[model samples]
Target: MKQGRSLLASGFVAFLLLSLAHSTLRIEPERSDASPTISDPAALLALQTRYRSLTRQLTQLTPSRPYIVVDTARNHLFIKRRDRIMLDAIASTGSGTILDKPGETAGQWIFDTPRGEFSVQSKLVNPVWVRPDWAFVEEGLAVPISQADRVEPGVLGAYALGFGKGYFIHGTLYPRLLGKNVTHGCIRLNDDDLKSVYQLARVGTPIMIF
Candidate 1:
């Protein structure tokens, strides 16, 4: 009887050891659901090259006739004709000042030379400056109610090339302020430069300000 009990206990121990070994030594199946990731350096470079080519094709400006290019930050203006530069002169652009109005109907004005493509809509000799509301407000004066009060003569020098929205490339009485950012929102040049530009730049001529 004693021998049989001992043999039974030995068999139980062997069974437990085998069960523990089987539980610990598991072999999970390899994960086949994950997608593979691959990177090609040449493919990335080819995409970048295509994007640059498209951008260059889009931004290339090929003017057939005379065009004006204004460099506002440098206070310079250049008139170009095909491949030749017709006129290059010092200029005065916007002052970039801000005026704040505080009230229910209050608004603000940013005196900046707008950057984009524009065209000469009109030309005037001895152009009168019909001062806007901001002009009066800037000087700390009351805005006039009558139209006659806004008509200030002989301020826009000898010539004016009107782009839209009351902006102009015109002559300045303040010739000393040339090559400086001093205008309210116009391009100011010396009398000689203004005369040349006014005569050369026709209506519908392209003007690019940067």
Candidate 2:
């Protein structure tokens, strides 16, 4: 019985040593001390939260009115509806001469389109061009040969106006030379934009110039 007890003790010792060896072989090696820690849970959450807030704010800030701006310097016209631009186009202005007058000789006249805040008092289709007496006098030219004289060839220049009694928004024959402050004081637009505005806008539309 004493010999059997000795053999059992030896077997238990051998089993314990084999188990320790197996555990050591299965263990993974330690990570290098110089390696960076990989955690960024807080930063990821913060970025997501900020993106959502920005998206909501953008949705809430849309505009609700129509705004029109004409930049004489840029020679561009812009019309916006509710913070979004609907029309962007090129336009021409008076030849920097806000007034027209006769030059030193008859048939010689200098003209300048007037600039100011004017309202669109009326819109005309197939508009007729009329020559006023002042236009003749200013150019030192003879009075128009006849009243109701729609006879001046170059006088009309292509478009006519009735804005503010004598001013106008019209088309120009010199389309190539548009985007210039070079008309007889009328605001000139490209044919397409002119048609669009003529159709869309009505009498008494406000126009402010800078």
Candidate 3:
């Protein structure tokens, strides 16, 4: 909505292209006055049949329940119920930075946000961030042997929605960094947006990232 375009419209266009790939006729974006029309009634009928089938598939694929859509490229997150968008907020996603592992010769991590479909697996209030090894390494601090040394408080806003494998949609201390790709891998939202998300989402709420 920030861009004044529905992300679902892109999906529909993609679906239409995929559906047309299997058909004999092609739909061109621009045409001259002499553009050929389907003179054969049978071919026109086949095209109509494919249209109906594709429409049905798209309708069936629409989610009935509320879901999250993260547009990592645009740095925006949306909460949508079917065709209606419930919330659209500026967010910070993965930075795509490469950090070398301290001990391993070739080991490194590319901190790009994970894509594809995922669901909210856990939600926490007043979340505590147990800082990982990368955090210490990035800061050039010595890695602590004790786990207690890793417990960090207050930096990760008030709420966190975990989507498994150490990734979360959480609050950020630097709300000014919203709309930028500057996170380790988690999605960072402002406090107000995060609170709304935490209240709206559930344990199994679907999160679609792209």
Best by lDDT: 3
TM-score of each model, paired residue for residue: 0.70, 0.54, 0.77
Task: Name the regions of candidate 1 deviating beyond 4 angstroms.
Answer: 1-61
What's the best-to-worst order under lDDT?
A: 3, 1, 2
- Measured on C-alpha atoms, candidate 2 has an lDDT of 0.55
lDDT of 1 by residue, 1-210 (tens): 454334333333333343444443332444689543326767656655655654443224335467788889999999876447899999999999898863567778888999876778899998998899888888889989999999999888989999888899988888899999988889999999999999898987777787
Candidate 3 residues 1-210, lDDT tens each? 322123434443433454464453565434676675788899889888877776666556555667788989999999977567899999999999999989756689889999876788899999999999999999999999999999999978999999979999999999998999999999999989999999989987777788
lDDT score, residue 52, model 3?
A: 75
Candidate 1 TM-score, C-alpha based: 0.70
Q: How many residue pairs in model 1 have overlapping backbones?
A: 0
Tens-digit lDDT track of model 2 for 98-210:
33444554553345544444455667765666677666665667886777662445433333334675777777667787777776666778778777666555564445444
> 110, model 1: CA deviation in Å?
0.5
For candidate 2, the C-alpha RMSD (Å) to the true structure equals 31.4
**Residue 125, candidate 3: alpha-carbon lDDT:** 90
Backbone clashes in model 1, listed as residue pairs: none
Q: How many residue pairs clash in each candidate?
A: 0, 16, 0
Clashing pairs in 3: none
